[model samples]
Target: MAILSALRLTRAPGAAFVVMGLYWGVFAAHVPVFRDRLGVDDALFGTLLLGSSLGLLSTMWLAPKFDQGLGRAALPTAAALLALAWIAPSLAVAPMAFALGMVGVGMASGLLDVVMNARVSQIEARSGRSLMNANHGLFSLAYGLAALASGVTREAGLPMIAVFGGVGLLALGLMPLLSRAPAPAVAPEEGGAVRLPLWPVMLCGIVVMIAFLSEATVESWSALHIERTLGGGAAQGALGPALLGVTMTLGRFGGQGLAERLSETAVIRVAALVSATGAAIAATAPGPMVAYLGFAVTGLGISVIGPMGLALAGRMVAPHQRSQAIARVAVIAFCAFLIAPVLMGGLSEAFGLRAAFGAVAVLLLMILPPVLALRRRAAAPLAVPA
Candidate 1:
């Protein structure tokens, strides 16, 4: 009931989240197929994924300007671009071409991500309700469904074009739902530099960054881990990421109500420990069933961490500064996505995928110190300008 109500409040931005999930979910499930077609090892493939850093750069420099210029149209426009951009990699057989295609996908995804998250923060401020968890929960649901569907498609021996085309068209169909009322204008940076609580923002960003890093590592590699490492079939391999998505859906939705009742810092602390244990289990799992169990546990615990971190960042700033603060956090958080594929690849190449996953467990545990710092800072009263 609480999640349903939060979804009602955030339906517009939630549509963008859903669209983003559909693309990435399908892509993640198809990673094995894509890699085989390119005929490159994990290391080279990881290097190719570095192309997304270009998109990260664009998001850092242009997303704010793009958001300001397009206002209400930004979300739909970015959605359409993503739908179109995803077509490139689906068709590319060569490594270089595929890398370039990822650039388009990454840029479009980052722009949409920043705009939608900012919009949600705005809605949270206006409605005085916790909505990010529910919105992100919808993303997980869409991602899980798409991964399951893509797995079936792969088992059917369908071409990448077919799977990607279906997802692209689905994204285009959802564009109208993303349209919404214009946001209230924010002061231009030149108007005056509002003194930001930089330390708190950085702390929250680190939390979000770690959460996404774990997510990206799992999404990009879990399928391969199940198939090659545990001898799972295509459908079984897809279940790895699918289970993560499904459990995350539950966690995020549950976290919606929990956020209102619990201390966000305490929630982060507990979630990190829970997720680390799950990752450790997955790292040492002997079979597909056990790996699924691990992924499920990891998903449930990690789901709320990123949303809680973003919510913390928003609360630490004033209304006019909300967008800027969230954007900063997002920029930092997105570094995880940029680094995850390459880092996981390098780690998997050097050690086995199991060890790579074990490293993720360690990374999850490392976020505690930052959470401690954020807890102290969050205790301080904010100095909002009139």
Candidate 2:
């Protein structure tokens, strides 16, 4: 009954995840149109995209203050910002306009990411159920569907304005649902405000970094690997990301069930090994079909590691500190996003994509020791204020 209730309660945060995915999906599919409209070259457009990352980093640093001030209101506020920002690119007439718009979108996305995850942690603590995997799964599913829909609309000659407008409207419609959901009550520190421990938090951050690095490698490079390395055409290359996305969605859903039946550490250990093996297979595959299979296996293996790491971090501190802890870990983990493209690009330029991916496989295996450390510490009591 408790689990059922928790499942029902996930609707609010899950909806936020879906909206986020929808915006990103539409943005990715319409990038060419946006670049053409702004009259920018590939290098210039790439530089503009960096504006989003800057905005993300700035807002993420400020998210804890928003949480402290707004409490339950913070979630919807960020969602509203995202909705408003979603339409910026559609309305841009020049390069500067588009860059400025991306900054807004990035800021809003960063805030939403932290707040929504923190909300899920609060719910999990209160309901005594695992919700992260299900919530994240919903995100991946929405992203896949939205990307497909955007592609179809583009093929049918729809404008970027209409596509982004529709996505913004969908986000607006979800705001009320998110805003009305009450924030879970956190237990007050018995003595005073309790500081979160450092080492465990750093460990969690490291685990998440590795997870994102592996995921980014598969997502960003799989298509190139398929087309260039495996001698496949565009359609076949497209299947690489599609296969990873589908398997990731399925794996996350499965992870939700697995969390109920096994310890978090056990799940992480198994997931790491599976991901490593998949990466190895993908790196060495001679054909697109076999590479697709490898990507699918890798997707399944990595799908749950981020959510599990976040859950473990949340559990390590007092409820009131969950947001801050999550933010700290998130900030560090997100650096992987900034670092990965450059790292993979450099490696691919020098050693080729297959070799780059092979290095990624080795990095995936490095997650196992951290999982073991978490398991060893699971039996120890957290030093909460009393």
Candidate 3:
């Protein structure tokens, strides 16, 4: 019965990931509409998107408290907030209103991100399993399906509000699943939580930021690149992100199987190189089909970085410090979301979109040295916790 309970509980985190992915997938599909709705150019829209990150940053400080205070309740509550907040951006008519709506979305997304990841870490610790990749795979699958569906819906002439409203309702429907899951057990070592070691944690945070920045660049900007730069139609442009999502889903499931055979360092190093190569291909792709292939390659290569990084962070800390440790790393990593859109928008505005993509390739390659350093240090005898 205990084993069965564990099996059942594991589904909660994956479901949460899917719900969040659905929101993002729909958002990605509707970007052109969003831009037109607010009457902003790419650069201005990027700046507006920064408001969500600001809101995320502001609310991140509360993550640990939520984890400590709410326990299992935290995930559902944050998810519910995310569901409601997702509608705000869909309702906005002006720039300020849109920005304000993004703030709410960011706050909710940030909270949900931290809590759900923490729950997954706890689940892995208890189950002695590598579940991160699989859970994230579910996210990518949902994202891909949602993006494709949204494209069809838009082509069918459904209003954005109606589309987004359905997503919000789906999230509400998933809330009950969380209630059925067991709460994570706090271990003895974690009873009195102490300060997590700053040096390694900071290093891990940097790695996560680089990974997230690379991934977000493609996910957020690829559609616009396909449509504006490559002259793809709406359905074809939507295919860019959708294809990325599909490949990422496959890659993460592959990572789940590989985790036991390979070290996190090994996986990340190879993944980064592959991601850089994919970025380069994307930067030079002359046509939409070629660009789609590039994005798909990029997705497959970067798929494991975020989940693996979070899993590594979880392993480094005491069981009790899981939520707080993951939160700290996430706060730093999520800043990529804050920076990537604006940076890419400015770069795309100044140089071409191709140039902007080239910069992403450079950023991905930069992870190699850090990954090597981490592997070397991890090989040494541990005097500190992580």
Candidate 4:
């Protein structure tokens, strides 16, 4: 019963998923609309989008710091700020205004990303079980639903800004729930000093980095891959990402239970290998339908890595040190969010998008050694008190 209470308390971050979903689903679908409305060419639109990505990147480092100062209250407030800021750009007032708004959105949403997850970690500690994957899957679901709704809202001639404003208001309404969420068990940056036998934590971060790279590529380019590589229609192209989202969401849902049933090491190993296979198949598939299957496989394979990595970090360290340790891992992972797009984009530019993807596919094999190290550590006997 106490554990249930704690889950209820820590669960406020789930609302963040809704806000993120609303924001991501809407923006991703409406980028072309915004570009046309603003008279910006593809290059300019790309730059603006990159700005938002940059804002998100900025928050990756500050996640631990933000939580240190504000704790549980940070998410809703930041989320509200993010939603409110959309008012300027969604309305299409001016180019400079939209730029400003995107920057603020980026920063707020990015910070909230880390803070909310950190908060969940606190909850997991109190609840004495794993819940991160489910929480994130909920996030994925929210994004998918919101994006689905965005399409409906768009067709109804509703301004994207209005849609965003309404979503933000909903977020505001939910802020109290987020605020009331129980305080997490540890500070956001609690685990800073524990040393491991391998992977430099930073290197482990890099190992996982490629996985993120592939995800970003799919997020940014799946539609294009569908349209160009598979000769699919625009509608089909659009659904490519949706398919990816659905697969990832489902994967994470199953992943949560799987992580519990098996060692995270075994789960991640299989997951990576599966994801690699998916990426490779998608990269080489000759048609749209086949490509999407590959993407789905990739999504399923990659879904568990994030939550598993986080949970492993928590178990590896002393309780007081966990938040910091996980925070460090998050920083590295989020950094991948920043780098993956550019790297994949570059690869896509230098040699077809397929080539870019194939490169990412090849790295999936390397995820094993570090996971094995974590398993060994987990299997070690606890020390007896002196």
Top candidate (lDDT): 1
Task: Give candidate 3 regions above 4 Å deviation.
Answer: 1-9, 67-72, 184-197, 314-325
| lDDT per residue (tens digit) for residues 1-386 in model 2 | 53345547888887788888777756655555665688765446556666677788788778767766787888888888888887776789888888798888889999898788778867776777777777788777776666557656766788878887888788878888888655735545676555777877888898989998888667656766776788975446556665666777888888877877988788888999999999999999989888988888998999988888887887778777876687788888887766665667668767887888898899989998877887777768877755
- Between prediction 1 and prediction 2, the one with superior lDDT is 1
Model 2 ranges with Cα > 4 A deviation:
1-5, 28-49, 68-73, 88-101, 154-161, 183-195, 220-239, 285-287, 315-325, 379-386
Predicted structure 4, TM vs. truth: 0.81
lDDT score, candidate 4, position 128? 70
What TM-score do all the candidates reach, one by one? 0.94, 0.81, 0.91, 0.81
C-alpha-based local distance difference test score of model 1 = 0.87
| Candidate 1 lDDT, 97-178, residue by residue in tens | 9999999988988788878877887798799876778888999999998998889998999988988888778777777788
Deviation from native of the Cα of residue 15 in model 1, angstroms: 1.6
Ranking of candidates on lDDT, top first: 1, 3, 2, 4
Stretch of 10 with least lDDT, candidate 3: 1-10
What does candidate 4's lDDT look like per residue over 281-318, in tens digits?
Answer: 98999988889798889888887787777767656666
Q: Count the backbone clashes (under 3 Å) in each candidate.
A: 0, 0, 0, 10
Candidate with more favorable, higher TM-score: 2 or 3: 3
